[model samples]
Target chain A: MSPADRFARLPDLLAADSDLQRRGRWVTVDCRVDVGDQPFFLALENGALAAFERGTRLMRSSAFTVGATDEAWTQHWQPVPAPGWHDLFALTKRGVASMEGDFRPLLQNLQFFKDLLALPRRLPERI
Target chain B: MAPVLDPMIGRYLRLQIDGVDHRVYFEEAGRGIPLVCLHTAGADGRQYRHLLADPAVTSRFRVLAFDMPWHGKSTPPDGWEKSEYRLTTASYTAAIRAFCKAMELDKPVVMGCSIGGRIVLNLAIAHAAEFRALIALEAADFQQPWYDTAWLHRPDVHGGEACAALVSGLIAPQSPPVSRHETLWMYMQGGPGVFKGDLYFYRVDGDLREKVKSIDTKVCPLYLLTGEYDFSCTSEDTLRTAAQIPGVEVQIMKHVGHFPMSEHPAKFREYILPILEKIS
Candidate 1:
């Protein structure tokens, strides 16, 4: 499946998972994730994914953007990534990923994003 | 380049501390009074790579940096994989004591940053006469809350990455790009669960508020330095802690952060030289 399709599935997966829903509750933030060339925006409110959209033009309300190479994203979405590709911070630290704009929200809800991003790794191969 | 001095050497020593054998990895350079440097939590001796290379430091003092067990090149003892490795004050001090004894370092001037910084207080309090002095960077009574560790223990949450982000946030906003990236890279390479295990000591087991009053500066002079942007242990935190310990000297490192030695070695060295001069 294309990265966009996989990203689009995140909202539903987040909603269905009770743990993420509860943990993300009261966390409202607009974030952008750039996988390879494909850029996606996620609007999260009250612990639920409010919106998931594709493209680079960010919502004026977006707080931060997390971008990584396609290869890095591919490795990250694997069931078990190698040393450098396992975490978003790891990618940023290794220069494989970049995070821009306001970082407060990103750090304030680090685990939420950490769990949210790992969702795609659990999807079936056909998805 | 100027004339090349002696090159740094990397070696391992087998030592039994607290009844467990550990293969400790360490780097050494120069010859003179021993200056033992300790790296931050989850990081190894490589943080002092530049310090080891600096002739100003090496010419006067024999500098050595060792990787704590389960960190950097140091291997964990038997059965470590099955159980979580937590760094309590007792375990940390024991390793340092054993390391010093094995190296035959007579009252070495020990310096450490972050968890390395926090443990030096314990070293001074328990074994004051063992070291000539103590230099602590980003040392505090306790670290403030930054990231939640519950997710770090989860299977989906990669500890190394989570730790990198947590540490990156504490770095000074004005740190140079190359230095910042280099410092971050160190966190990325940490062993699994090492960061979290070390925090247990930094945050919980290493609380020195009640214990700091017992430190005798005359026996082992305590020097505290905190970076301007280190939110984990702010300058204010170090100052407040320093106020309690009589004769303890404190300084605020401008435009630096948690990892002073690694983040900006040249800048950090400038601050350190004055201190070393006073001691020498």
Candidate 2:
């Protein structure tokens, strides 16, 4: 899938997943290069950023290369001059906060709901 | 040219404690009394890198530095005991204590910047026998009654962005992208965890002011170092917080922000090394 398409569908996937429903319907895009720096992965998922990082339902930040590549996803990432380290850091922080705000309910009741889900439901006694 | 001193490189250890390998990067130089150095909330031990590099500074004492659990080389436990238990000052302090026991050193003089300082306070008080002296820089108490009225209500603070900048500053101005990423990830994990922990720490109604004052770690010649432009806490508030703890030696550095060690290492040593000497 193309980068834009994949990133766009991220929200839908999160919204559809029952497990991530608690993270609320929000998508965040994070990009990172692999260990070898050969391939980049862009994580587009519908849910709060914090949930991806700290909670379950693993999320990967989107990654791309600096030069030409045959991979379909790789073509989607065009050359964009990188910001200063400080500016990029600021952007990430803002984006994370924005994700958190978008998924406020999840951020708010995250602990309570997660704990509740972990507990076995107490079904009403059979009449 | 950043100060032309040798980069202090020593055994970066990983001690298995509480089911996780707690990585401690420590360099012991000029032994007299041991100084256990802890970095601020978002940064790792290397924040004190220059200060440790200075012969004038390292000449005074042996330094035990560790990237706190979930920070630097240390990663969070493979399996958490509980879901919401990953970010807690108490748990981090336990890891530090475990590291100390593993290394088999007396409490020595414990100095921490920002959250590091707060952890030291937590450790010293909870494990009173562990600490000989205490130094805390720009400790935050967002849950405090007064700060809630001021800090929370202030719209201009930009807490999140400010925090991000601080993170960038710590790692930036660098080489070897692999090392940089590793460092960044360590901080990313540590920052969110510590920030979350602080939110929990300050949720109480009564001020921690009294609890901070009550810590019995023998005053050990308390020292407070902060930047003039510290966004974490106002200069007035920093002084006030220092005053709450009886008989603390306070020094305010000019033309600096929240991360004094990063911005002004020489000034930091000027204020810090003397105390290390006295303790030694």
The sequence of per-residue lDDT tens digits that candidate 2 reaches over residues B3-72 is 8756566676768766666556565555656677877654577767666776776766667777765555
lDDT (10s digit) by residue, model 2, range A1-127: 3333333333334444565555434434443322111333434344433322221224443322121122322322222211211222222222311112222232233322222211111221121
Badly placed stretches (over 4 Å) of model 1 are: A1-127, B1-6
Best-fitting candidate, scored by TM-score = 1
| CAPRI grade of model 2 | incorrect
True contacts kept of each: 0.03, 0.03
Model 1 chain B poorest 10 in a row by lDDT: B145-154
User: lDDT per model, in order?
Assistant: 0.82, 0.49
Worst 10 residues of 1 chain A by lDDT: A80-89
Cα error, residue A17 of model 2, in Å, equals 45
Tens digits of lDDT, candidate 1, A84-124:
45556656655778888886676656767777887888777
